[model samples]
Structures are given as structure tokens and as C-alpha cells.
Target chain A: MFQDFKSDPFMFCIVIGVILFVIAQSLFFLIRAVKRAKALGISNEKIKNTISSSAVFSIAPAISIAVTVLVLSVALGYVLPWIRLSVIGAISYEVPAAENAIEAAGLSSGIGADITDPKIFTAVAWVMSLGCILPLILIPLILKKIQKKVTGAVNKNAKWADIMAAAAFIGLICAFLGRGIAGTGELATNDAGEKINVTIGDGAGILSLAAIVSSILFMLALTLLNKKLQWKWLEAFSMPVAMILSMAVVVLISHFAPGLAAIEWRY
Target chain B: MMKKNRSYIDSVHFYGRIWCLLALCVMLLVPTLMSLHLKAWPDLGIVGKAFAATAVLFYPTAVVEVIAYAPLLGAGGTYLSFLTGNIVNLKLPCALNAMENVKVKANSEEGEVISTISIAASAIVTTLIIAVFVLIFAFNPKFTALMQSDTLAPAFKQVTYSIFGAIAATYFVKHWKLAIFPLAMVSLLLVFFGSIPIGILIFVGVIISLLGAQAMYKLKWV
Candidate 1:
């Protein structure tokens, strides 16, 4: 009678309910920000562009997250992964958290295994939910204090704040790039939270380098075109266009020019 | 067009706390509702054991991320962003792009509003896409195989690099002076150590870049 409890109807209700809550919260903030943007005299045109371009920018990345849902759905069923990927979940940790929980429950959850037992379901869901909940708690308590300091800095030294903002993103971009190229380190955990060693250049071997290079070229081209040609409207679309085009280029390379699209270290 | 005090930023925190707290409740309820609906309260001791293991690995990562990202994302963005997740790959870039397009400082009133708008848009779009994907996968088993097709796998595999590369282009090209120090330092570290945790790397990344920015500012080079 309980053959497929993992995808049970009741489970879908809970997942959908939580997702709806997220959408509602997002809408509330969106509307509030839009109204505030206007009072601040940020042209309606600017707000509109930000919304539209941000929506466009999100598509390729969101599709990739959907792919994560597909991957995790195999072990725990669809609803749990859907919820996990949607909220407070990072791709790096969700799978490992489930693996750890299942290992504790004495069941193997190696992606394709038949881990649909009810006990396994409860265990995976609980761990995936609780494991990433700290941010939910800590963000509320500390974000305000953190934001205060940032605002204080900006108000105190306007020039320095601008430099700090620029520095913050540059550092993040380079760090992620280096991490991607240098390979995830020994401290990086595997599916069950065990530390694993990775060769320094192992992450560099990714044929996905095609996508990175393509994105760089595409973005630089767009930026240059915008500046030289004064295609002011084109500036907002650059990030999304570059990302989507880069993904498309890699897809073609992998299929037609297969060797050029070597798939390595997807994480 | 200026105010005596930062009331708007304060209101952002005001409304932000309510939204974030409410979201947390719903998050906790996902598991709570599941156990009730299934009539299967997981054995407390086992749940505890597994949680302790997972928590040890993730809890520190979460703390580090919050500290690193809060300043960049601002009050409203941070509140909404941490709840929605996928900060670096998605939200951070979206907010940055929006601010760049509009030409505002990240900590300014206009930047805060713009950041909130873009992040909220990004979050909604992401949730909606995943929801649609879930429905399709549930209705049609073949859809999974189609999505997993070899033709599309490469794109999925390269999504992060695609995102970071695109985001990096914006900052590095414009701020080459400031970019040089941190990017070089990261490269040196990756080559020499090759094994730092990403959470720690992020902390390192933000610190060095700030230092780089400070040094350049003092030198009047930027």
C-alpha cells in the first residue's frame, strides 16, 4: 500500500506550500523595493530595467538548479529535493548531508540506490532540512548588525565604501575562479562529509573551461560594444546574454566537437 | 535628495526581520509537516546522530558565508538572499549587475532598493523555474532522461564557471589595479596550498580584496 511514499501526494502538498511561501515573500519584497526605488527618484525606467534584466539573468542559473533537483530527486524522491534546492540549500552540501543521514540510518544513498524506504525518507529529509538551517537562524540575528556596520562605513567615508564594494565582488569572483581552476582542496568533503583530497590542477582539467572562456569573451565584447557604440540599452542584458550564449556554445562543443567539451569536476 | 538619517535602510531592516523570521518558520515546518503527514516521527536518537554529523560539516560554512556575504548583499538583500540560497552563483551576480547597470554604490539607499528588487526577482524566477521542472519530471519520466542527455550535460556541468566568468569580467576589467593583487594572491595560494576549504577561501578572498582596495586608495592609484 505504501510502495511509493516518497512521492506521496501529501508530500507534494508540503513542498508546494513551502515554495509558495517563498514566492510570496519575494513578491512582497519586490513590490516594496519598487515603491521605495521610486521615492528615492530612481527612474521608473531604471527599476523596470533592473527587474527585467535580473529576471533574464536568472534563467540559465535557475535551469541549472532545476538540474540539481533532478539529481537529488533520484535518491529521496521529487518533493524533498525540490524543497531542499529551493531553500537554504547549497549544491555542495545537500547531497553530502543526505548521504550522511542515510549512512547513519544504515542505508546506502549512492544516487541510484533504491533508498526509498520510509525510514530513509524521514532521515534524508530531516538532515537536509536541519543541516542548512543555521543560516536561517543566524541571518536574522546578525544581518542587521552587519548591515549597520556597512551602512556606518558608507556614511562615514563615502569614497572608501565605494572601493570596498568593488573589492568585495572582485575578491569573490577571483576566489571562485581560483577554486574552480585549482581543484577543490583536501578539506572539501565528499557525499558523506568525509574530507577528501583533490589534486591542485584537477579542477583545471574541466572542459567547462570552454564555457568560462566563452563567457569572458562574450561579456567583454558586450561591454566594449556598449561603451564604444553607446548601446546604453544593451548594458543591462550583458550578463544573461553572456551566460546563456556560453552555455549554448559549450553544448554545441560537447556534442559536435565532443573533445573540446570535456566534462570534469562538475561541482 | 538626502535625508538627515538613514530611515530607508532602517525600514529595510524593520521589514526584513519580519519576512526572514516568517520564512524560517515555514522552513522548519517542511520537515515538521512531513513527519506528521507520514505518521513517522523519525527516531529522535538517530535523527540527532545524523544531524550532528551534517551540522558539524555545514554549520561553520553557513556562519562564514553569512559574515562574508552580508556586507555585499546589504540588509534587505541579505535577508532575502540567505533564505533563497545559491548566493554566489545567482543572487550576488544579479544584484551586482543591477547596481552596475543603474550606477549606484552597493551601500547607498538607491543601491539597497535596487539590490532588493533584483534579488527578489532572481529568487522568484528561480523558484518558479524549479517548480515547473518538478511538475514536468513528475508527469513524465522520460523528461529526466531528456534533461540528462549528453548534449545538455556539458552546459549543466559548466554553469558555475559560466556564472563566475561572466561576473568576473565586470569587475576585473574595470578595476584591473585592485584586481591584480587579490587574483594574483588567490592564484599563488591555489598553486602552493591547493587544499583550502571554499568557505575559508571566501573569507580569504574578501579580506585580501579589501586590503588591496585600501592600499590602492591610499596610493591614489585607483
Candidate 2:
């Protein structure tokens, strides 16, 4: 008993194109590192530097691109105002009669035409701004901490904290997948084509199914790709493709479900 | 050694000649289709105004990077700005690589290696701070959702997963470094010149980028 959100196809394609370009470019840097390594005579010390540099260099651009695009979109919305229409206008005929009647009555204001309230925009903007910026700053700090712990100044056994953190991340990922799936299930119809009702009760099964499928696919692809191909291109395309496809599916389901973002707007 | 660098120039020429036309075509078609289907086409005046507005907002960092922080002098700051700009909104690779080589002078008796690491770390920190500022105050998912509709969400999702792809691709390719300047320029052109047809501009830019790159290579710029 669930309905899925409809995903926007146009966005999916746009994201795909972006992903391709980023990956393609990153691969270029990797190639450069290799050539540079070769040029330097590929000694043990040089090779190590080359490897680390390549890895770190790639990380910089990928992170930069992602964060930039996300933040820019939000910022532009703020600095520049935009209008979004929610309710569709109703159809009408007898325009001449209506115009004449309205003229006689001197009542010409159109009903049901409402500009979005400034308050809601301000509130949403505030929340969005916070969401975009906070994590960007914090994530790197957290990553640095993790790196420090993993490669300790003093060598020690792997800490329980790291293990717990990994587990938590996995759990969060599962939950996200489950939510997507559960939301999608609500949009599904029965044999009679009646819309299924989604509530807390039926959310578990769909979520579990989606999570299991996603995990299995992720693991299988990782293993297979690692076995067969060099790491760079595989890393560049495979994981992102999976993430985008799943996200697109979930979003599409939501879009088609009229009840999903069914927030009532008052102007 | 010089010959090897020169070969890079030739490769850019070869690649750029073919790809520029394709990019140009795509650039032309995609935006036009988007406008028609979405009924959201902006007239020339509107587009120009919007473009100008965006440029103004970016000008501060641009000026700092391009002028105050000259590539040869204020390399670190310039690079930091370039990286921050990429992470914030636009993906122009303008002076990022050149900034990477900025020398970090440690007051202490630290060696060259230590100094280099310090510089890199400082750059990273600066980049993060810029990104945080952008994200915390400038980002707007709601409007993005409006402009992109629901599709933007999945693209984001794709991006999350694609990190691994970036990592992997960066790890394995040979001579990947040569690709950076061209890639960065292409990304810049695509993001800014939205009016240009992607296929055609790509075709032209790729050609131009390659040719330009080859010329640089021949001149031993690499």
C-alpha cells in the first residue's frame, strides 16, 4: 500500500551528463600522474608520491564540483527572486459576458490568483542555506579527523569508534534507500488500479526490499569491477550510475504521486 | 623530454578539432529544447542581465584571483579562490592548477616537503571555508527543485554515488594530468555559455582547447 514519487527525467539526464564530464576530466588527471611518474623514472619513493597525489588530487576536484554546483544553485535563488505557480488556473468560457458583468459591477480582481507569501520563502531560504553550507564545512573536518585516527601519529589497533562510525553510516544509507522504496511503493496500484494507501504500517517491507537490492547490487558491482578492470574508470562511472538511477526512480515515483508534496499554500 | 610535452600539444589539436563542433551543437539544442518544453525561455535582454548579475557576484573572487593574487605571486590565494569558486557554484577551472604550485614559506626550519604539505593543507582549509560560506548562506534546494523540477534531486543522488567514480578514474588512468586544463575550460564554457548549443560548442571548444593545448605544448608550456 504505497505510491511512488514521479522522478524528473530532464534532471536525470542533466546529472548524467555532468557525471560523465567530471569523471572524464578526473581520468585525465590520473593519466597525467602516471605519465609524470614515468617521466621521473618511477622509483619507489616517486611512485608513492605519485599515487597519493593522484588520489588526493582527484578528491579535491570531485568534492569541489559537487559542493559548488549545490551551493551556487541555492545562492542564485536567494540573490535573485523567482516565481513558482502552484495551483493551475481553472478553464472558463463566455469571456465577453463575464467582462461586461465585471465592468458593470466594477469588480475586476481575479480570484484564486495568489503570489507566494514572502514569509514561507524566507523560512525555506534560511533552512536551505544552512543545509548547503554546514555539512560542506563539517564533512571535511570530520574526514580529516578520521584520517588522523586511521593513520595515527602513534600506531595502534583500529579504534572501536571508527567501526561504530562505519556501521552508523551503513545504517543511514540503508534507511535512506528504505525510505525511497517505501515512498515509491505507496504510488503503486493494485490489480483494480486503485491507489494503494501508504502509512507507517506498510513502509517496512518495501524499504527492506529496496535496501537489500541496493546493497547486493553495490557489492556485486564493486567486486566484479575491481576484478576485471583498472580502478580509475570503474570508480568514475559505476557507483554514480547506481546512485543516480535509484534516486531518479524514487523521485519520479514521488512526482507522480499527487499526495506527496500536498502542502496547502496560502497567499 | 621536450618532445614528450610537444606530443601533448599534438594530441590536444587532434582532439579539439573533432569535439568543438559536437559541443557547439549540443549547446545549441539542449537549452532551446528546454525553453520550449518548459516554456521558460528568457529573451536576450533577460539572459544578458542574468549573466551580468552572476558575473558581478563572482567578480570579487575573480578579481582577487586574477589580479590581487596574480598566478605567479599570490598563487595560493588564487588557487584557493578557484577551488572555492568551483565548489560554490560555477565550475570554471580558471587558475586552479597554477595556484596549486604556490610556495608555502614556513618561518621555522622545516624542509621543502613539510612546506609543501603545509601549503596544500592551507589551500584545503581555505577552500573548505569558502565552500561553507556558500553552502550555509547561498544554497537553495527549493528553487533548484523549482527550476529543475523534481529531476534535480536524483542528479544530486547520482552525484553522491559518483564520488567513487571520480576516485576510481583518478586512480588508474595514464597521463591523466594532460586532461585537466582542457576539461576545466570545457566545464567553464558549458556552465557559462548556456546559450551556445552544447553539441556544436563542445565540437568547437574541444577543437579549440585541443589546438590551443597543442600550441602550448609545442611552446613547452606544459
Candidate 3:
């Protein structure tokens, strides 16, 4: 009765409807925010700058996210991944969640697995949707309380408030940076089934580290150019430009200099 | 201006809640309808096990994120960002850039408005891009092949690192004093202990950085 459900038109229609709903939500907020910005006396130029730069900044990351959708679609079908990635699903979280769901269901866990079985597919959808549901639930319940306390604390000491914000951002950066660095080491299995790693710096870890360094360099160079050339407009595009260029460079290096690329471990 | 701002925020909360609740219902129905149509309800036990595996880790992280990101995102921005997703990677960065460009601080009303504008723009653009790609490329073998091509794999893999690295560099350089201790401590942990979950590391870094900054402030170093 449920055969051909994976690529069914009904499934695609549901996914498309969800996507459109999200788009409408985005537009609602966008129109409201723009009006508020105007009421707040922000210049049209500044508002335009914010919108254009943000739209520019989002392109590379959105493309990367699309790539994720494409990869997941191969296994889960286009409808589910498209809906998942467009909504609360992230690349890092969705892949693992799907694999775990498949494993828990005693199904083969990988892209090549036959996931067309309706029961198996239903289980996956349920698991994936339920897994990330907490944030949606929590945000509505506690966000206002949290914001009130945070705003009160910050308002008490404006100077330290800036420091607090800066520190939080720094902490986030350090976490990502630390992870990138840690990924560079080599791992080996021991007799006790424990994995040991040597810091050889020739894997995805090192490649990621290199990408970070190259992107930073590109940003610094852009900063210098902006200063010397008085090209203020470049400031908005600097981060995205640096990101795209750095990724392009790494891709070229990986293709031409295989040794420089992160080694893919095969079991 | 203050009264106007407060009322606007209140209205945002009112509308935001309704929109999010509706979105949540739509999300739930995706699976519910599929099950009804296919007549294949999943094993509840299996679903529970899978949910536990992911939720145990993610639930706490989600709580932490709302706390960590609310100030930066403000009222309207926070509601929209949480609903639209991609907070750290896309929304936060867009808001940061907008605030920086507009010369507004997050604590100020101006900052809140600018953040909302930027995040809303980002959400719109991201959704449109995804929609276009899904419609245009989902059925095309050539597009799928190109996306999965060996030559482009490294670029895709490094995209997150490059994006975050550039952002980190910009902010770290600006607040080097506040950044040093946390960066050093986190780097040490990574070096010695392999990899720590970002969720935990963020709190560790925040606490250390806050303490360090406070100490420096008391010492009149800034």
C-alpha cells in the first residue's frame, strides 16, 4: 500500500508547503523590522547596506547548506532532506540523527541503504522531527524570562555588558578554533579497542586549520586594502569574500596537491 | 522612543509566539500525515530510543543557546532566528555585521532594530536560495553529480571552517585582551583532550572570558 512513498507527490507537496510557510514568516519579520528601523531613525542607506550585505553574506553558507541537502537527499530522498535542512535541521545534527534513527530501527545505516520502506522512513521522519523539537518548545516558554534577566544585568553595568557580549563571542570562536585544531591529529586503534591519535597534521583537521588561517589572512588583507584605498564598501563583503576564496583555494590545493588534503580514513 | 520601542517589542512577542506555534504544528504534521497516508506508524520504542540519543545532548545545548544568543539577537530577532534556524552560522554573523556596520551596540534599541533587520534579511535570502536550489536541482542528475564531484568536496568540507575562522579573527583582534585567556584555555583543552563538544566549550570560554575581563576592569587595565 505504501510502495513508492519515498518520491511520492504528496510528500513533495508537504515539504513545499512547509518551505513556503517559512518564507512567509521571514517576510513578515523582514517587513516589520524594516519599518521599525525607519521609525528608529536609522538612515535608508544604512538599512540598505545591512540588507544587501546580509544577503551577500548568506549566499556562500546557503550554498553549503544546499550541498548538505543534496547529500542527504541521496539517502533520505529529496522531500525529507529539503524540508529538514530548511527548517531546524543543521548539517552536523541531521546526518547523525538520521543514522542513529536508522540504527535504532535495526536498519542498515548509510546513504546506500534502502530507506524506501514506509515504516523505516516514517520512523526516521518521526525521530528527526522529535529530536530537535526542544529548542522550538523552549524558546517560546523561557525566552522572554531569559531576555529580561540578561537585559537587566546588562543595563546595570553598561561597560561590563559590552565586555560580556564580547567574551561570549570569543568563547564561541575559541570552541570552534579548538575543535579545528584537535581534528588535525592522526588516530590508530590499540589492542584494547581504544583509539590513539598522533599529531601528524595531514588530515581533514589540518586542512580545516589551513582554511581558517587562509581566510583570516584574506580578511586581514582586505582590511589593509580598505584602509589604504578608502574603500569602505568592502567592509561588508569581507567575511563572505574571505570565506569563498579560502574554500576555493583549499579545493584547488586538495586536487593538485593530494598530500596537502585531509586523508579520508577507510575502514 | 523608549515607549515606542518597548511596545514594538511587546507586539513582536505577541506575534512571534503565534507564528512559532503554528510553525511547530506544521512541522509535527509532516510526520503525522506521512504516517496516516502510508498507514505505517513507526515503532514508538524505537522512536523513543533515537530521540533519547539525540535529545539528551541537544536539549541542553538548545537551552544554552537561547541564553547565549538572546542578548545578541534581541526580541524580534531571537524569535525569528530560532524559528528559521541556522542561528550561529548565518543569523548571528549577519546581525553582528549589521550592528558593527551601523555602529550600534547590542544593548541599545538601535542595535535591536538593526539586528532584526539583518537577521530577517538573512533568513529570507537563505530560504529563497534553498527553495530555488531544491526546485531546480533536486531532479537533475548533472547538478547532483557536480555537487558530489570529488574536485569540490574539499571546498565544501572547509566552508564552515573558513566562515567561522574569518569571523573569529575579526572579533578576536578587536577584543584581544578579553579573548586571550579563554582562547588559551580552550586551545589547551583541545590539545590535551582531543575534541570537546562546542556546547560545553562555549560555556567554559564564556565564564573564563567574563572573569578575565572583570579582573582586568578592576585593575584599570582597559
Candidate 4:
């Protein structure tokens, strides 16, 4: 059973999931930076520069993730057998036997069977998993080096980078909420003996539209409340966060709900 | 003006033309590797086939092809196109490196933005040119059949268009915020429909985006 998981193409899931996790944290940092800009009431040009710089900075990890995934994807195609043996193995007892063998090999720990079992399903899941900060921890130090080289000792563009980071956070969140469902849905099974089609189709279109509308409204609101929001970065981040949260809620509700219940939250 | 042009040429040195050259060598080697692999395992697994296909598309040869001919086609336009297509999904690092290059020459914030925009424009134009070439060269039955065979045409077309789509997307995302939606839609449609070669789709999209950008200029949308 554990070997099945290791051999399955789903192994790539762990790698991609870790990448998404990094993306999520990066967005949070971006939000904080945007809030800072809103408090200061920076100029649009300045805001844009900040956003663009931070965007550039944030893009590094995202690119690394994409490149790593692409390379891994290529590696998968090159080394792995394309035709899945899952169907045959599912009906056979070989899967469970293999699982037991692996567990026996791992019994040296002398722990409980559940814990000692290498087939616990979580071992292979953790193989490609870099710790949470593995991807993101280098970003600030990298940015600082880049900043020193670009703007010199003064760190002139640091503020602008902060603002840009906020915008990136918003973009990252939007991507996460939009694609995360699809990603998770790939693993989703139809317990009811139905065909598992993960695509949300034109249904999610309505949620996307609402997200856009609410975001625009939120941005306008933030602009109007600019002075009250105090922090320019906070004001900048609010519209995007509001939009992201709204979309995330819509997607999560739709995904978790049953078919009939899912349709209810579509709009 | 002459002196400024000369200075611009000088600055290309700072852009790490060496890395660009390395990318070129990789493009050339990819096809050879693919052919060798194909000979070794004609019926490799699905993953294997995917790798081979990706090699054809993203190989350093493609990069080299763009860098070598893009400038020769007109100026640095094609080189930028190749660069843009190669880095489309990976924008941040590309942009930051580009920003560093701009900062080397630009003294003011406005100058930095302008330089960045100009590089972007040139990149788009170059990619458009390559897309046109690939589409016409690969998709046209006459061209494909004459060079290789009819069956080879589809493979050629796929890679050509992939590059075209990638470059067009990069350009669209940089200029107008709204441009991304339509460009993305068109790209999806093109990919799904296997419509005319990627170049033709991108050519059409580029024209439309240009018109839109011009209209925005007229309406002060920028």
C-alpha cells in the first residue's frame, strides 16, 4: 500500500503542495508590506514602484518553484512509466503485502505497529517536503543582496518593495484560491460511484465575477477611507485581501458542499 | 543619438550575455539528446514522452534560435522575444535582473520605468516575429512536407505555437491590466481548438492588444 503511494504519480503532490504553501506565506508577508504603504499614503507612482520591486523580489521563489516543478515534471515523464498499473494492483492483494513488507523493515524502531510501520502513508509524503520555511526563508536575504546591488547601501527602493510585496500577496492569494481547489480536487474521489470530474466548469465563473466586483468596491472604499486607514500599505492590501477572502470562502464552500449544496453557493 | 545608441550596445555586456549564450548551447543539444533517447526507447513511458516533448520545446536550442536570429531579423527584437518566451511564467527574477540593468543607466524613477517598458516592448515584438516564422514554417503543409513529412508538421506546429503563446502572454501581462484576461482567453481557445498556428493567433492578438493599448492611450487609460 505504501509502495503504491510512492509509485503513484500522486507523489508529485507533495512537491507541489509544499510550493503552494510557500506561495501562501509569501502572500501574507506581501499583505503586511501593503498595509505599511497605505498607512503612509504613498504616491501612486511610488506605490507602483514599490509593488513592482516587491513583485520582482517575490517572483524569485515563485519562479524557483515553477522551475523545480517543471524540471520534476520533465523528470517524471522521462523516468516513470506513463501507463498506470493502479487498476490491476487495486484488485490484487500485492498492495497490502508490499505494505506489510515495508512496515516489517521499519520495525527496528520498536514502536507501536502504527507508528513503526513505514507504510503509514505519511513517510513518502514527507520525502519531498522541505520544511515550511525551506522555500521562503531565503527570500528576504536574497532581496537584501539584490537591493544592495541595485539601490546600494541606502536601500532606497525598500519601501516600494514593501508595497509591491502587498500586491504580490494579493495576486498569490487569488492564484491559490482559484487553483488550490483544482489541485485538491484532483485527489477528490466520488464516494457516490460517480465519475470524478474535478473541473468547476462555468459555475466558478460566477464566483470569479463576484470576487472581481467586491474587490473593485473594496478598493474604492479603501481609497475613500485612505486617511482613516492611516497605513497606506494596509489600505492597499484591504481590497485585495477582501477579494481573496471572498473568493476563498466561495471556493471552499462550493468544494466541500455536496453537489446540490455546492450549486447553492455558486453565485 | 548615435552616441546614445553606441552606449546602449555597450550596456548589453552587463546583461550577462554569457548566460544567454549558455542557454543557446542547451537549445542545440536538446534535439540531439531527444533523438538519441528516441532511438534507445522508441516506446518509452508517458512520462518519458512528455520529457522528450518538453526537450523539443524548451531546449537551449530554442533559446539559441531566438537569441541568434532575433537580432538578425531586425535588431535585438527577436532576442528579447526568445528571452520573454523562455521566462514568461518566471517573471520576477527576469524583471529584477532587468531592473538592475536599467538602474545601471537610468538616473531617475521615470527613466527606470521607461527603460523597463521599452525592453518589454522590444521583447514582445521579437517574440511576435518568431511566432510568425514558426507558424508559417511548421503549420503550412507545403513547408513541413517539403522539409520532412506531413506527420512531422504537427510536432513542429505544437512547439512553435507554444513559444508564440508564451511570448504573447508575457507582453500582454506587462502593458495593460485588462489585456491579460483577453490574451489568456484567446490563448486557451487557441490551444484547445488547435486553431491556426500559434504565430497567427499571437499575431492577431498582438494587433488587437496594440489597438487596445492605442485606444487606452487615446482615452488616457494608462
TM-score of B-chain for each predicted structure, in order: 0.90, 0.26, 0.90, 0.30
Query: Residues A171-225, candidate 2, lDDT per residue (tens digit)?
Result: 2222222232322222323455344544422232322333235533653566468
**Model 1, A73-184: lDDT tens per residue?**
7787788888888997877788778877777887644554657567667867887888887887887788888887887888899888888888888888888787767644
lDDT digits (tens) for residues B1-222 of candidate 1 = 333465777777767778878877887788888877777778777789989998988888788888877877878899899888989889998998999899987777788899999999999999999899878877877987888887886688678788888888888888888888898898789777666766677779889999989988999988
- For model 1, the superposed segments whose C-alpha errors exceed 4 Å read A1-3, A184-202, A263-267, B1-6
Top DockQ prediction, candidate number: 1
Error of 3 at A184 (Å): 5.6
> Which lDDT values do the candidates have, in the order given?
0.81, 0.30, 0.78, 0.30
For candidate 4, please provide the TM-score of chain A on its own: 0.31
Worst 10 residues of 3 chain B by lDDT: B190-199
Question: Chain A TM-score for each candidate, in the given order?
Answer: 0.87, 0.33, 0.87, 0.31
DockQ numbers for every candidate?
Answer: 0.64, 0.04, 0.62, 0.03
Cα displacement (angstroms), candidate 3, residue B141, comes to 2.2
Candidate 4's C-alpha lDDT? 0.30
Model 3 clashing residue pairs (backbone): A203-A262
By lDDT, who's the top model here? 1
Error of 2 at A207 (Å): 38
Error of 1 at A250 (Å): 1.0
Highest TM-score against the true fold, candidate: 1
Please provide, for model 4 over A188-255, each residue's C-alpha lDDT reduced to its tens digit, 9 standing for 90 to 100.
13544343545432222333333334434544454456667576554423322333344344344344
Clashes per candidate (backbone, < 3 Å): 0, 78, 1, 24
